[model samples]
Target: MRLRLVALAALLSPLAACSTVSEAVKGPELAPVGYPAALVPRDQSVLPLASAREPLPQAASANSLWRTGARAFFNDQRASRIGDILTVQIDIDDSAKTTNATTATRTSGMTAGVPHLLGLESSLGKILPGGFDPANAIETNSSTNNAGSGQVNRSEKISLTIAAVVTSILPNGNMVIQGTQEVRTNAELRQLTVAGIVRPEDISSANTIRHTQIAEARINYGGRGDISRVQKTPAGQSLIERFSPF
Candidate 1:
């Protein structure tokens, strides 16, 4: 019984050592769950467009038609102030088609012979096999043909309306805008983000502007859900594949 107990202990010792070694190789463990909300920090408040060089006038002159450099009437609803919200119309319809074809052919032939050098034809015939003409001693022929064709056809269209906030006013009076919209259904979340600079004069009378008018624009639309997880590889396996040389 004592010998049997000793044998069992010896068998378990290697497993314990292996577990320790595996833990060391793995280094640190990650959290089992992820917090999607913590991906980006939330802004508590909007920042000013620029620093005020001088205090605003306490009161406007009575006879002055313009009040404190106002560009339009007070009733105009155009977006001119920081933190103001405006509607942005996103309409994108794009299509492209391209085709290319290439063909190449190459052929080469080589022949080497010695007719009669130093009158050694008889000697060469004796050394060479019968009907083996020295003129055709070394003849080679090669042909190569290559053909390639490629085509691309793509079309995309997205139409949506999103409300954007005036994040900042540029020195040239352009407005920097940013907008985000998120929709949640069941366990899925779809997010859309847009940011860009727009000229104030380009805004329509209806207080809206098309996405095409935006400069340096960035748009993103995607979703995260069960379907997304199904399309993605496991995190551990993805890491291994990325680091693998073969």
Candidate 2:
């Protein structure tokens, strides 16, 4: 019986040796799910890129426009330095327009190759106010264009404020920022100054132009809004109401 068992074991060993081993190695691998890559985080407190904020359309606001703030804003005497107390005010009003009758286009917003700094100077001193100076001006000439569910509200003037400490000035006249801040002008102050500047391209609707002004103010933020009086949420509205978009 022992001899017979040994013979059977030898036969099984030879049969096992006759079988071939696979050259390809097999291992566990992962399958990719069809999920998209993560998106970047955003802070909605500020304006979003490519969002609808354009200068006022068709309806003209003012006539006198100048790119420089009193021409003094860019003067050598006006160049500020660190520790200088710079009082900055942003404004929109009819007085800020500049226009030439030679380049005037009808109110259709399709310009006949014209230029304006948020306004047409032709209207300045000629028919509209003389100059749109911010420090001593009021913005009270906004007109509303409402169509169906989309209603656009324009303040005749909307002014936003920003400030910088002037850490350093580049040799070629670019001012560096030590620290800068933005301020929300009083609602009373912005009520009438809705003059939006028409830059190289017409990217401003009266409202968007206003919004761009606010973004510029952020270059060097000034300070926080004095919104302590404002309730975190409207009275009688639930906490959910503050965040319920759906």
TM-score of each: 0.58, 0.24
lDDT, model 1, position 201: 73
lDDT of 2 by residue, 17-55 (tens): 332222111112223211112442432122222221222
Error of 2 at 66 (Å): 25
Report the CA-based lDDT of candidate 1 relative to the real structure. Answer: 0.71
Identify the leading candidate in terms of lDDT: 1
